[model samples]
Target: MSSLENILYFQSALGFLANMVLLLFFIFIILDHRPKPMDLISFQLTFVHIMMFLIGGNSWLADIFESLNIKNDIKCKVTFYSSRVMRGLSICITCLLSVAQAVTISPSTSLLAKFKQKHKKYIINALFYIWILNLSVSSDMMFYVVGFTNVSETKQMQVTKSCSLLPMSSIIRGLNFTLSTSRDVFLVAVMLTTSTYMVNILHRHQRKLKHLHSISHLRASPEKRATQTILLLVLVFVVMYWVDIIISLTSFLLWMYDPVILTIQKFVIYAYPTITPLVKISSDKRIINVLKSLQSKCHQIF
Candidate 1:
């Protein structure tokens, strides 16, 4: 097999393993909670991420099978379509999560604060809209994607029999890129802005506590901890996502499919879902307690 094929296989295997770990962590979070609004959003994101891993991983696996003279068009198409849907949904859900987090941290006096009280139903509604919007936008791919044989002549190769919204005419591709980039920028801005305000609020609250000689300074209250955790997660997300974006954009502008850029993008995309579970484990006492209980039970069983 060619070196390019070998690298693809290795990256896909790594992504699959990482996604499995992320799935297990999110499952732990779900089993330990009664599905708060935030939990629901996290669960949705995790599910999509797993779907992405499966779809992308399967495509790579299919390549290996084909190289060994095995043909499975049905499996290839299924993997391609599933991957497309999952990727679209992943992007939509990321935006939903940012909006949800912003609403959660909004001041009670702010109009957005109403979401805190009435979020469950609204979240359901918004999720429905996101799925519909993504499905509509990505439907064009179903017509263009054919198996490897069809794309063997093209510079932009298809890993499997899947269609992407990306390999269109330059004008169309630019439009799609603009839309995707704008959505990401807007979501990141919202997350950073709301998180910054929340941190400031927590800081002011801390200063007020300092003025009270009767009250002792604590390590960190639940609200403060949550605020800090959210801030850290957002920072990690912004840095990782923008780095991937910059690499991708630079590659596109240079009209080159640089292997280094592809590798970095793959890692960032695979790692994104792991962040939420890590944030919860670090910030939520209930989740930590559940993990501890599970560990003790396992030890006893052994």
Candidate 2:
């Protein structure tokens, strides 16, 4: 196999492995004695991550299909649409997760805290809307996507099928790009602002507690732990997303549509969702206990 094929294979294997681990981690979280609201959110996030991985894995499979000279139109469309929907869903859920965490950690005086009693229910409602919004924005792509045979002659020599948005006037393409970019920037700003507020509140809360007690450690409290976990999750999300945005923007500005850059973008996008469940498992005591119990049961069975 060529180097490109090998690279795709390795990446696909890694993505699949990560998805399996995330699935197992979330399962343990769900089986825990007392799952928290955050744990449930993490569970839902990880489920979406698994779907993202599966969708990404299809890209690698498409490569393999090309290597085998399999030219199937239905397979191409299914892969294309599934990947697009999964990507859209992943982005929406990630923003939702950030908003959920912010609400969870908001100070009592904050307007968001007024809805504390109904936070989980609100999150559920928000999640429903996120999926709907994503679907509405992306559904038009269904009419535009076509397999290899339908693309321009310049791209016809490519073995793997191409799925692209239909050609539009330059003005229309510009408008589409502008709208998409504006929405993305707005969501990113919201996530960043909310995360920053949460971190500041957590810091002030920790300092206040520290001043009140010199002899007692402040790290052992459930609230403190939850705050730390959310902060860490937010930090990870921000860093990964910003890196992706930088790379994507550079690629777009340079007009360099290299497959390698696209590959890297896919890696980052898939990695974001997949890591969330594992992070939750590592930080959550109840999930750790459940995983331990499962390990013990498996050993006994063996």
Candidate 3:
């Protein structure tokens, strides 16, 4: 057994435990009977946990086949492409949340000022589009991605059939990189832009108010809190994703295998999902209260 296998085993085990915790949290939220936004965010977090599980399990699944002769198998395709679907949807969900809040908080006379109030009922329809759009775009992943045997001719390396992109020529590689990363870039850009716009709106509103300590200034406390939470979420996502992109580019240029980068990359892949629930709990009063009540009951039982 190599360090790679060991790390993979550790990652899968750790991720499984985290995923279960998230599942329990989701169930608890639903049982708590909260309404609208919290419920929606809880469901979204549940999807994120599932996404991490599906992607992280690749390590364990790779270890199952002792040899490195993976082909274009249907099972491999399902596992690999399904994760893509969830990944895309996760990003879109965040983008929607950011933009929705932006619209909700727009100046009263603006065109989209009442968009949130008017269209809150159509959230289900919006979510359906997110799922369909992600699933459709990610369909190409099943064809291009597969379990491939990495056989090194120049050096002695273990041949493993890991879930990765097909061994393609330079042209194909360029095309894939351009198309996929372009989509990701667009989504991330929209997310960040909307977040910034929301922040700007809040700042402007604060400046226009006469008294900072007056209740008039504090009437939008909920909005202020929500903005802060969304800003934190956006910051975390940007830092993690951009660093991952940088490391990916550097790794592509490197000559030898650096386990450090590989390890960091793997950890970062799971970092957002792991931190997401905790972040939500810290920022959300409803989830916080629910957790506190559960804690009190547990203490009494023990």
lDDT of prediction 2: 0.65
Model 1 Cα lDDT, one tens digit per residue, 1-302? 35655665665565555555555666776686567776676667767876776666665666776787755554555566676677667756766665677677667888888778789889888888888877676665455455545433464544323432235577865775787678778777877777777777777777787777546665787656766766776777778788878876776554455445565566676565555555555577866676688899999999
lDDT per residue (tens digit) for residues 1-302 in model 3:
37755765576566556656556666786676655653565477566666666665665455554355454365577666767677777677777777776776778888777675655565667777888888888887566554445636423221124434544555765666678778878989998888888888888778777455554545557778887777787778778888877776665433234555666676676666666666666666766676688899999999
The alpha-carbon deviation from the true structure for residue 181 of candidate 3, after best TM-score superposition, in angstroms, is 1.4
Q: State residue 297's C-alpha deviation in candidate 2, in Å.
A: 1.7
lDDT of 2 by residue, 1-302 (tens): 35655665566566566657656766655675455566556666667666767666676667777888876655566676666666666656666767777777777888988878987777778777877787677655455445655445433222232643344555664565577667777777787777787778777877888888864565557766766676676677778777887886675443345566676676666556655655665767765676688799999999
Please identify model 2 stretches exceeding 4 Å from their true place: 1-12, 28-34, 59-73, 150-166, 215-217, 246-256
Ranking by lDDT: 3, 1, 2
Write out the backbone clash pairs for model 1.
none
Better of 2 and 3 by TM-score: 2
Q: Considering every candidate listed, which one attains the maximal TM-score? A: 2
- Candidate 3 Cα errors over 4 Å, as ranges: 1-34, 59-72, 153-161, 208-220, 250-260, 295-302
lDDT of each: 0.66, 0.65, 0.66
